[model samples]
Target: MESQHSSTTTARAARAPLVFVLAAAVCAAALGWTYWAFVQTTTGQFADESAWQEAGVAAPDTQLPFLRFLDTLPTISVVIAAAAILFVAVRRHRYGAAAIAVAVIVASNLTTQLLKNVVFDRPDRGVATLDFNSLPSGHTTLAASAAAAVFIIMTPRWRPFAAAVGGAYSVLAGVATYINLWHRPADVVAALLVVGIWTLIGGLIIMRTGNRWNDWQGFGTGWASSRGWLGLCWALGPGSLVLSAVLYFSVQAIGPAPVPGTATLPLFFWWGLAWIVGVGFTLSAAAGWLFADQARRTSARAVVP
Candidate 1:
């Protein structure tokens, strides 16, 4: 039994890095596709621009909150990430895990800046917008990465709820950037993907290094690790995507053709918002599942002795 368990453990450990690498590859591919579709194509540019134009349709009373959130987003993100990292380092004494989490945060943000400022460029596809590139939004990157850092350092049992809350927070930050016209939909999505890639890489390392603390007995072990939280994430992730598809198609089927420089409706804005929610929750749910599975396998192997 011990030999069999050891063999299983070895097999799983070997496969774990491959899983994370594949996940990161998916995010990278998605990021590339987002840039190609939204930045390089005429129709894509039109849709993105229409969404930005419609942002002004938001009520004056409602705009202030989003604006304020954007204004203080950096400070809030820093404090939250710092507190979480400090807790993990001091209380948990998982110094390596904490350091890796911080590295994920910094690397994600740095990669975004590099992609936006140095690697990417917005060609004039006759979109009648700013020529400077903003495909991967800086604000969204900071928000998502910070939340991801916190999520990374959490115990396996606590990670499900943490993913949900962190995902919601990141979604709100992305939507705020969209509503305030700080970024287009693709920009926010790209930032989420970027952070996701780093999170996977960082999480794999942390799981390997801190395997003892990472073990868990699957979901419903506690309030924070309850299956209901993951269920909610699953529901919201796909539900929001369905909502976005329905809204977009329904409007196209019934409403008039969208005219430039005119806010016919906030269809694009709502559509963008839905996409943000969907992507954020989906990523969160995926992360929770990955970590939970890894932890459960670890727990199983430990019991064989």
Candidate 2:
């Protein structure tokens, strides 16, 4: 039994690096595809423009609250990430993990800015929209990276709950940017992918370097690590994808051709919102699963005397 457990742990640890690499590669590819599809193609431009235009139809009463949330988002994200990193470094004595998490946040945000301003360019695709490039939204990147930073510093037992809450906050931030006409749907999705890439890299480092505290018994060990939280994310992620597909096709079947600046049903806005929710929860669940699996492997190895 001991030998079998040891072999299992060895196999899992061996596979961990490959898994993280593949996941990060997927994120990078998705970021590239998002930019190409939404910023470089005519059809993509039309869809993006349609979604942005639809935001103008949002209920007037909701604008103030969203605006206020955006106003506080920067300060709130910075404070929360800073506090979490400090706790892990000072109290938990995981200085290396904390430093890696901070690097993830800063590097992800800086990458987004570079891609949006310097690396990418918006050409005249004959879509009557702004000519400036905003492929990876700075605000979305900031919010997602902050959430990811908190998630990284948490123990495996508490990670599921953290993932769900943080994912929801990131989704809300992305949706707010979309509804407020500050960014298109593609920009928000790209930002999420960018953070995801950095998070995966940072998480792999934290798992390897901070293995002492990374172990956990598994899900349901506590309220925070309960299966219920992970189940919620599982449900929300797929449900939002289905909802987005339904809204998109239904709108296409019923509505006329999309014309810039023309008043239309808010279905496009809802579709984009659903996409944001889906991406956020999906990434959240994936991250939780990855860290949990790594922690389990670490725990198994610790007992392999």
Candidate 3:
């Protein structure tokens, strides 16, 4: 029976990385679709415009001060956060976690810049807008990567809370960028996707390294369970989608009229921002739960006499 259990655990452990990889692929494809739809399609351009105007309105009244703070949240601050997380992992002797954390941060940030500057070109999609590309906001990417670093280093037990707090912070940062007109919703979403890909890569590395400290106690009935975050993600993900759809169709019913800066823009802008926050937080929470669960299972196996 012990031998059978060991084999089962090992098999499950082996499958986790594959699951993460497949999920990563889906996120990448989603990001591509987002680009093609919003960047290339006419309707997408309108939606982008709406989102931008909405952000501008919100920036001055509600989000400006917050945006300024986030804007001033320097690259060094992100580095310090990553370093602190890395230090915790190293102190716990989780070298694999430390390395993966750094990789996720460095690789995700570099890829965001590369895509914005070099690898991907934003053609004139006929939208009357800024000339430069801004599909992935660097500020949002930095915030999200720092969050990912935190999620990567934490043990399974702490991940649910981390998921809630870190995911919220990242989502807030992304939304602030939109409100401040730093980037569009697609830009923020793309940054989340980029961080997500590196997160999967980092997960794969952690699984391979087989760090014992990564494990956690099994789930319980409480709200803090690994299952709790997963459930919250499910709720938030679908709920946000439904709300966004409602907003989109309701605005569409009004028809594009009056003027550019008045009616549809603000409505569509909020709609796009809603989707961005939903997608960003849902993905982060789900990924956090995935790692936490995997760690719990692996740790459980490791402790068996």
Candidate 4:
């Protein structure tokens, strides 16, 4: 009986699929981001071939090198790298996990930058032709890669919160990239693609790690259970964003929409989108809370019978 129980636990752990999921996350993030960028910039450049101008969203102007540098910092990645190393050292007691994580992280950076150049396609000096390869963004790859690294270490109980935090960090990377370079805003969104894919992938990979993040779900951890999962997303992520977007446009139609060289409240309206979405950052985790609560009640009823 003891051996059987141990084996069951081992099987559950194996299902986490950490490395495989990491690779999957990388593929999703990279491919999705590349698609988005190509559509936004490459397609535009292709049309005007000579303009070398891509029809994508340009980043807002800013002058904060220090902040930009901070945003680009690989702090989260470093921490994750450490955690992965520590886990292997303690549990597996092998130096390989950490080594692989570090190598992947470093290699991902190179591949990411290479892809960025290819997709964004800036031309040589005195060239009037449009460049092709800048579709998949490099900075985005970096940001996403970092997020992926972090997600691998996160517990499911921490998944929602960790993902949100990861999103915020990726945003920081975007800000830094934007301030330093006028790279397409679409390019920055590569970070979003990277992080989202990994979070989803890594979430599934290590779901059991956070089987019970707490005695009970706490702040940021969503209501437990399948229903809670859907409800959390509806209440926060998509639903809230939809609400904010509607409100933004409604205000614009009702009042004066900020036009170019105008008041720029519309930009604030845009930022409002971010604020509303942030709710999902926490509420999504709180989603799991409902599931646990329901299960407990069911177990209680069964016992009473």
lDDT by residue (13-99, candidate 4, tens digit) is 543355445645564655564444334453322222211121112234344663556554656456655675577557754444344
Give me the candidate number with maximum lDDT: 2
User: What's the lDDT of the predicted structure labeled candidate 2?
Assistant: 0.86
Off by over 4 Å in 3: 1-12, 75-80, 220-230, 296-305
lDDT of each: 0.85, 0.86, 0.75, 0.44
Residue pair clashes in candidate 2 = none
TM-score of 3: 0.87
Candidate structures ordered by TM-score, highest first: 2, 1, 3, 4
TM-score of candidate 1 relative to the true fold: 0.92
- Find the number of clashing residue pairs for candidate 3: 3
The segments of candidate 2 whose C-alpha lies over 4 angstroms from its true place after superposition are: 1-15, 254-258, 261-263
Clash numbers, per candidate: 0, 0, 3, 26
Worst-scoring 10-residue span by lDDT in model 1: 255-264
Model 4, position 285, has a per-residue lDDT of 33
**lDDT per residue, candidate 1, 1-305, as tens digits?**
77876855763574267888899999999999989988988767767877777776744456789999999999999999999999989998989988998999999999999999999888888777878889899999999999999998898878999999999999999988888888888899999999999999999898877865776757776789887777888999989989987876765576524563365567777777788899889999998888888777766766664
